[model samples]
Target: MGELVDRVDEQDRVRGVVDRGEAITHHWLHRVATTVCRDGEGRILVHRRAADMSRFPGQYNFLVGGAAEVGESYEEAAARELTEEIGVRVPVRFAFKFLCRGEISPYWLGVHDAVVRTDITPDPDEIAWHAWVTEDELREMARRPTFVADSLYALDRYLSRGEAARADPLP
Candidate 1:
């Protein structure tokens, strides 16, 4: 049996449940959660996906997460993914959410950010390599094709929002 995931509509409303592989193959809108981990020095954690993974194999991803299981909330999925992919359990802050239409999978991506003070033990099956990189360094790496598409999109959206927020101060 395959993993069961929640199927969502264009507006992110839960439609029903389906197998993860079927969701990907049919391009069904599904729930996905991603957690971006950062250190005290402001460096972000980036990891290379295992070469055998179905999507974005061997590509660098700044976020660690996966599809939300049936009946799981976005936050729950985010925290669970963080712990499963990297051996770190920390409080994650909700960052943003967006509809991501990728080549292999279309999902409603729930993005979260966390400051990890604990040590990380990446799962060898999910992550090939891991590192801490400055924002500038991440941007440089993202310019290449080695980075995951959805991650780059999410990062760009997050940074743009940060810039806009910094530019417009509340009176």
Candidate 2:
């Protein structure tokens, strides 16, 4: 069997459990938790995904995250994904959630924000290339041909919140 995922409904309620592969194969709705990571300088972390990844291979994504497992809250999933992908265990605050009409499958995306006070150890299997960029640089990268579409959506919504959204600004 493959990784188990929590299948969700239109309302974002858990409906049942399915293997992540099955969910993707059948186009079942699931919860995906991701984060926008920034450094102390407020530069966003942009990464080129490893080309061997099953989903969005070799794509440039601003958000780093994956499917929420069964019984995992979006926040929990976000924190876990951060640690798994970027080797960070910092406090991740929820930013927003949206149903992404992804290119491969549909899923609810839970977006979070976290400031990295420490250096990140990116897993080579997940991140092929990484660099911290200013918002303007990110904006330019977003226009690239290989950028992930869903991540672009998340970035748009994150920016829509303006500077007054989060209580404490990025450290």
Candidate 3:
């Protein structure tokens, strides 16, 4: 049996439940939770996916998370994924959400961000290498094709929103 995931519609409403594999294979819209973990020095944590993983193996990803389970809320999935992938249990706040309509995999992504004060221990099965990099460094890296598309999209969206917020001064 495969992992069960909540199948969502274009508006991110859960319509039904399906196996993760089937959802991916059929390009069905599903719910995913992503977390951008920042360190004490204000650097974002990124990791290289393990080469043996089914999707985007050996690629760098800015966020640490996966699909939302059958009955799990976005917040619960974010925290659970953080703990499962990076061995950290911290409070993650919702940043934004977007519908990623890719050719192969389409899903509604719930983007979250958190400042982790503790150390991170990446699971070898999920991550090959990890690093903490500044925004400029991340932008330089984004120039290359090594980073995962979905993660990059989320990061770009998040960064753009930050810039917009800064431009709007408080009255």
Candidate 4:
């Protein structure tokens, strides 16, 4: 089993759900990733999803992330993915949440921000290309079909907040 999330109603009441396939098909799983990068620069790191990926192959994304493993919280998964995908231990502060429903996959994406001081070591199986881009550059890139919708939404939310240029350390 990959992982499962508790679907909730308007009042946040559990609706009883535990199927990844259904979650993807119906938009339910609460997955997370770290949109990590160098401190105070506000430059976002983008990655190219490997061509072998089951979903969104050869797509460009900013969050170094993955599905929340069973028994793992969103922050834990974000931290693990930051380390796993980029070789960085980032201080993951809550950034935003997204409910993405499309023909490809429906995933509840939890976006987290992390600042670090190290070079990245992307996993070849997961990432094909990588870059550190400015907000405007990312916005331009999002216009392309290769960018995932959920990630683009998340970046839009993050950039819309105007925190991308701040110098304060992530809490």
lDDT for each residue of candidate 4 in 1-171, tens digit (9 for 90 to 100): 555655544333456656666666775644544554644576778889999988789998877887765556668888888888877776887666666554566556667777765778888988999988887888899899989776766676777777544455674
Error of 1 at 141 (Å): 0.4
What is the lDDT for 31 in model 2? 92
For model 3, name the residue pairs that clash: none
Query: Alpha carbon lDDT of residue 36, candidate 1?
Result: 78
Q: Report the number of clashing residue pairs per model.
A: 0, 1, 0, 0
Residue 140 error for model 1, in Å? 0.2
* lDDT (10s digit) by residue, model 3, range 64-152: 89999999988999999999999999888887898988545999999887778789999999999999998898888877787787677
- Model 1 alpha-carbon miss at residue 29, Å: 0.5
Cα lDDT tens digits, model 1, 1-171, are 599998889999988989989999899999999987888776889999999998899999898999889999989999999999998888877779999887678899999878787789999999999999988998898898889988877988877776443221211
| Deviating ranges (above 4 Å) for candidate 4 | 3-19, 26-29, 34-40, 164-166
Judged by lDDT, which candidate is best? 2
Order by lDDT, highest first:
2, 1, 3, 4
Q: What TM-score would every model get versus the actual structure?
A: 0.93, 0.96, 0.93, 0.81
Q: After the best TM-score superposition of candidate 4, give how far the Cα of residue 79 lies from its true spot, in angstroms.
A: 0.6
lDDT, model 2: 0.90
Evaluate model 4: give its lDDT: 0.70
Candidate that would win on TM-score: 2
**lDDT per residue as tens, model 2, 1-171:** 889999999999889999999988899999999988888877899999999998899999999899888999999999999999999899998989999988889999999999997999999999999999998999999998899987888888898888777445644
